[model samples]
Target: MPSGRLPVVNPWRFETNQATVQIKVGTYYSQVWTRAINAWNSKKVFTFKIVKGPAQITILPAQSNEASLIKQNFVGVAYVNHDNTKRITSVQLHLVNSLLKSNGYTTSQRVNVAEHELGHAMGLAHNPSKQSVMYKTTRYVSIQPIDVKNAKDLYSIPASQYFINLPATTSTTANKDVIANGAGDRLFKSPFETRSVQALVDPSTIY
Candidate 1:
């Protein structure tokens, strides 16, 4: 169990501290994901096993309108799908190459974004502190001590204790829509492209 105060835990999580991951991005981005995985694995609070077939977490390049996302300054996004009991079934992390390239984000910065999204997949909410990788705009940060502590603390709790009886329409039907139709809660937005927007407090921020 966590020895200190707990960080914010998302309503969903894997059954354990480890999860299978599959990366479907380009070579460069694949390396970025790999580095991100290694960074988190170094923490030893959680583990991500690489797999070829269906995986609990899938990381892929975003196929959305690049121009629109660039305009919005979004670097990446994560969608989480869970069962009725709020156990996360699958997570899809989409990295925006167009935005990353156009904005001239360095390789390390891109890796930071990947780490941030992966944190969401591990059941972490955005941290208000800018020093943590789970912050809403996390391109400038790496996984900090708070991040490791939060992840370790979250997994220490029993899965059953996290369950909440959400409305049937939102929990059941909405989740099916997410798995089948790809319409679900957008759990995280990696980083904003423009520094101006990043400076402001976003009320709808989730990652």
Candidate 2:
């Protein structure tokens, strides 16, 4: 809302200001997720609750294929799924541990990346300012006042305005991918590129 601050991914927040989360990563990385969650929770603008059963948000270590995308410099990616009404249904957050380790990211730096991905899960778009946790590329920064204000602005919107009408033939599901590059340069994949992580890293394989 402030000058130079990016807006939220409009109308993409969960039904309420809070959502259930389930972390499927290892113990060490689980702690990282917890710290990131706590940071956002401290803002009191939004809340992420850890749950055992099905959850609206699921955090996990990157799969073999997904982890391989790290070679392109992406350290994390958040895949957001929504229902026909445009309400956020579930979010799959994959933390690419392989890249983080190979790049020698410190624990705090890893938490920074987690916070960035969580921001995406909360429907916050990337802020061009490097000081915010929602920066397009993950840096050593954590959540800032601007980030909190953005979340507050998003949740403050009335529930009635959250849904947008769609065509009768619209699919029941839709997805959006938000990626974080380790290099801190361009973070999103080119739309013309193939989805295969291996092909993305090795162009020769693409036909």
Candidate 3:
């Protein structure tokens, strides 16, 4: 709602303000993701718990450059699943571990990237302010006040406004390709275009 912040359209948000997300990793990277989740939980507006099993929100390590469905050099991607009503039912977060290290992201930056992607999953759009974690690209290592305010504002909106109505007619092959890409839900891409940091959304297929 603040000025200078980029608007987010058709935000895919959860039904409630509190929910746990499952991380798909069993490595040190999981620790970094935990930190990101903790950072967002700090706002007290929402709580993200790390759980197991087939979760509504899933976090996993990107296997290779092929993880990028947008054909750009990206570090993270988040796919959201919404029903015909438009409320988000599930989400998938993909992080490129090898690319992050090779591209020189420090432990803090890695955590920041995780946080940024999670923000996308939460339905926050890219903000233009460099100080905000929702910015399209940045070296920021954590969430800013504006980012928190943005989250608060986003959640405060009516649920009906957060969703949309899309056509139901879709192809089976496209669905298979999305599954093969590991984008377990509908694709939505992060707006960032460079090596700094970003989230992901797949627009090629419909679900």
Candidate 4:
């Protein structure tokens, strides 16, 4: 399976098995982004749908200057937003049109960059293997077994925390009802409060 440098804290992950991505109707590079989305959806690990409204993931076109500001020589990139506890809330991906053109990338190569950025948006890190789409510098146009294995492993690991602001009375009432019913409250709730938790095997071992 693909391997990568672990973040200082556990990586954030999507709450659901499926995610919605938004692309502007007439955005430049829309074709390549569509091809990339199809490439990822071909895998069974998760499904990605395109929507016209707000979405968990948003893909946009960028200029060569914007791409360079984010990272030198980057043709595409993905960014994730997380709370203090490391739960992923949103992701944004950018594709540099000028950079791709300057690099002399063909349609297939643009798709490869899109696929790689999407992998990062889905909590995938840079894999060392050249055959994997998550490689630091992508050489593959399609997702591979290493990519699939790593993605599945990530989803298998549960969130490390759930921090919701609730009124004291309502929070207490909810907890009481949960415990009274013998539900799995102990794993994530207390009689009158909620707290962060470290659940299950380490993500590194899931693979």
Candidate 5:
């Protein structure tokens, strides 16, 4: 049940039952955020969809906090996966214009930081390399390469993996390996799922 956020238990990943991120922005920055997420997901097989429309974004009075971030968390800090109903796994925004200026990143650079952290909200972990959007550090623009690969890997975990029940196995080499060892629930072909999925695990669900 623990998401990837718990580094001590499950490092390099995290998940939310759900999250509702309020993307606080100015009119111009609003456009920038949309463009960034679009470009970020364009190269990947998975896409992060906005849950609903007519969203309310919060744009607090900006303050100075860049130096504090670097010396402290090394990234901007926000509540991670703290949604009561929808878990907002992460959030970030420029606090003080002067704070970013103090740290030597432009407005665009600050947006990159925001985008990178949003990527984390979407279940990405920090990558050490500059090539990744998940990369811990960027030159101030462009999400390099490794960032996309890591995101894909995180996204590939099948729904079944979340639970303890294993299913039919597949081969590794020339022979199909029975990795599940027949201990899994069942691997019945589809179309029967709606009527008989309970049978897939146990027949008790059926009256």
Candidate 6:
């Protein structure tokens, strides 16, 4: 992976006041998964809530004959941060929506996707790290660290700027970002922060 940072030259923000969105669910349902998905969306918004009577479900053309893995229509869909305020369209995974419950994953997988897509609609791009919930691939059935971090970032910036965060304006010459992150000893660690080895390992980095 590239050691260089993706420039945060601009802070991310969007018009969230009275933001409106439309979620289209294709012809498939995963009641348990859908419930989980909805539950998760309810929490994504920082200042707003999913608008009451605003969430609409649409049953559209879907390739249902395919296996759950192959199914391309839906498990569920929602909007990002779309309360009575800001909005973005969100969608669930292809076919796994209904299939996950049978395999013991259940609603968690749908919850994961709902969180991720909503993350995107909220203006976050894919996080390349495997540790992230916003990673391009769905490796689990629940929210991960990346999910919380990015979501925090979504609301961190003030609404008026909507384009840049404050940190970028500071001179790195006087305020070295690498030196600061290095202070945290951000060396490689397992995706699971609570793994036994990590628990036993010393966090101090050796120069």
Of the candidates shown, which would achieve the greatest lDDT relative to the real structure? Answer: 1
Q: Mind sharing the TM-score for model 3? A: 0.72
lDDT by residue (tens digit), candidate 3, 95-123? 76655766677889878878888887777
Clash count for each candidate, listed in order shown: 0, 0, 6, 0, 9, 7
What does candidate 2's lDDT look like per residue over 70-188, in tens digits? 55656777766555565676787877777677777789988988888888788787676768787766557899988888988787777777666653123333343546433332332
What is the Cα-based TM-score of model 1? 0.77
What are the TM-scores, per candidate, against the unseen true structure?
Answer: 0.77, 0.77, 0.72, 0.68, 0.51, 0.43
RMSD versus native structure for model 4: 12.9
Better lDDT candidate (5, 6)? 5
Report the C-alpha lDDT of model 6 over 113-154, residue by residue, as the tens digit: 555544444455556565665554543635554555555556
Q: Against the unseen true structure, what C-alpha lDDT does each candidate score?
A: 0.71, 0.69, 0.62, 0.59, 0.40, 0.36
What's the true lDDT of residue 29 in model 6? 38
Off by over 4 Å in 2: 1-6, 165-207
lDDT of 5 by residue, 1-207 (tens): 324432111122234222343455566555555665566667763454443333212222333644543343233333232222222223333333443455566556656765665555555545545555444454355665555555555555544463234232322233222222121111222221110000011111122
lDDT (C-alpha) at residue 71 in model 6: 37
Per-residue lDDT over 1-207 for candidate 4, one digit per residue giving the tens place of the 0 to 100 score? 225643212255677557899996355478888988888888877678999899988876553457343334556656555443444556777766655666577888778878877887776766656687765566344678777777776775554333333432213345422122111011234444332221111112222
Displacement of the residue 191 alpha carbon in candidate 4, Å: 28
- Greater-TM-score candidate between 4 and 6: 4
Model 2 TM-score is: 0.77
Pairs with backbone N, CA or C atoms under 3 Å apart (clashes), candidate 3: 187-202, 188-201, 188-202, 189-200, 189-201, 190-200
